[model samples]
Target: MTDFITRFAPSPTGPLHLGHAYSAMLCHDMARTAQGRFLLRMEDTDLQRSKPEWDALIREDLTWLGLHWDAPVLRQSEQISSYDLYLDQLAEHDLLYPCSCSRADIRAALSAPQEGHPHEVYPGTCKARPISDRNQGDALRLHLDRALVMLADDLPSFQETGGTHKGTHQIDPDQAQEQIGDVVLTRKGERMIAYFLASAIDDATQGITHVIRGEDLFDFTAIQVILLTLLNLSVPTYHHHRLIRDENGKRLAKRDDARAISTYRNDGRTPSDIRRMVGL
Candidate 1:
């Protein structure tokens, strides 16, 4: 059996929240129970919005929660060049395209007799257009149509984290192909690369064997799976744990300061209390 490895990756966009606590604790506990190594990775890819103070706070919060890791956390903001190399690799394979469409244009152009994730379906006006012909836009999208055609003959199964299907739930590939089309690989105004690409590369290079995150991100799994295949990297097992929602059944956000881990910490709440609060 492969030695299990997991990581707690948090973006320092804002303070940690109840949802974050639940997810981090789950990763911490699972790695411990399985005798796996749990790593700490700071996802500060969004350079414009990410701050060192918040990064420091994230470290402080997780430690206060009684979670410690090996020295030298994997901070992604320091790894922009690596991301660019991967992009160059994809570009060499003719797998990426530049997208110049704006959000309003996408919404206006979409003729959706279709379903999608939280993001509205892209109209794909520039899907067939070449990158050179497109304007300098804020986001860059993966060429999904080309990607699927390439996978038509060799669609393969990627490993997901154990306990992913502890209940009755099913999803189909046909539905996946239809529902998700070309999505952003790099967004405008984002200093570094986007999450999907950064995540896949980091997980592969860091020797991560199990990728654990929230189930809300479950639908986006296909994008990363394709990334792993395109880059010839091993697909780590994915464990998308449940999220912490409030009475309204909405996932918690860092903006909700009342539930912010800093707020809780300031209120003299212990990490044990956080674990209990989020029912981890």
Candidate 2:
């Protein structure tokens, strides 16, 4: 069997919470079971919000949860040049286009309701515009329709090991247009890299074999697969596990500090207790 490599990447915008613990422990156990490797990554591309204290606390929380990684943590902020390189590759293929549309601009352009969210789909207003006309302050977006045509001869498929959706699947064109529209690869503000572009590139660079993440991200896997295929990177198996939610049946967010791992640690909860809480 090929070597198994997995990662638990978290943005250090806030303290690690129960949801973070659940995802981390799942990846850690999966790697251990395969006798392979597990990695930790600080997805701190959002420079404005990410904090040094949160980074240190995240490490402490992972250690407290009895989880271990095989490599020194990979920080996304340190790898800006790598993302630029991939962007250049896309540009060479004519798969990327500059977009100056802000959130308000996109919302106003959408004439119909989108599948998940209207804002999720880009109206493609700037797609036909010349690349030379794009300003330095504009964001970059993937020309999804053209990208699919570029890979029409050999689109990719991925294995999903997560319980909700198991087995291999292919990207469908109809769903791609409705659900996975032209996604922004770079932001206009201080944070230049988007989650899809950054995480997809990091997974390939880190040699992540199994993308063990939450089911909430299950719908977005197709975009990453497409990005990896376009960049000529190996696509990894995906295992999007169930999310850990609160008593109200709401998935926990970083804002839910009451459910933060640090709060539980301070409350005298043990590592074993966390495992039981998340149903390991």
**Looking at candidate 2, what is the lDDT of residue 240?**
84
Alpha-carbon deviation at 192 in model 1, angstroms: 3.8
**Pairs of residues at least 3 apart in sequence or in different chains that clash in candidate 1:** 138-188, 160-238, 161-238
Model 2 regions more than 4 Å off: 103-119, 188-191
Best by lDDT: 2
- Model 1, residue 78: C-alpha shift (Å): 1.3
lDDT of every predicted structure (CA atoms): 0.73, 0.83
Candidate 2, residues 1-280: lDDT per residue as tens digits? Answer: 5399999999898998888899999899989999989999998876767899999999999998888888899998888767888888988888777788775553232211222343457777888875566676677788898899988998788999888699999998778889878887875544458776789889999899999988877887898899999999989999988888889888788899998999989999999998899998
Candidate 2: the clashing residue pairs are: none
The candidate maximizing TM-score is 2
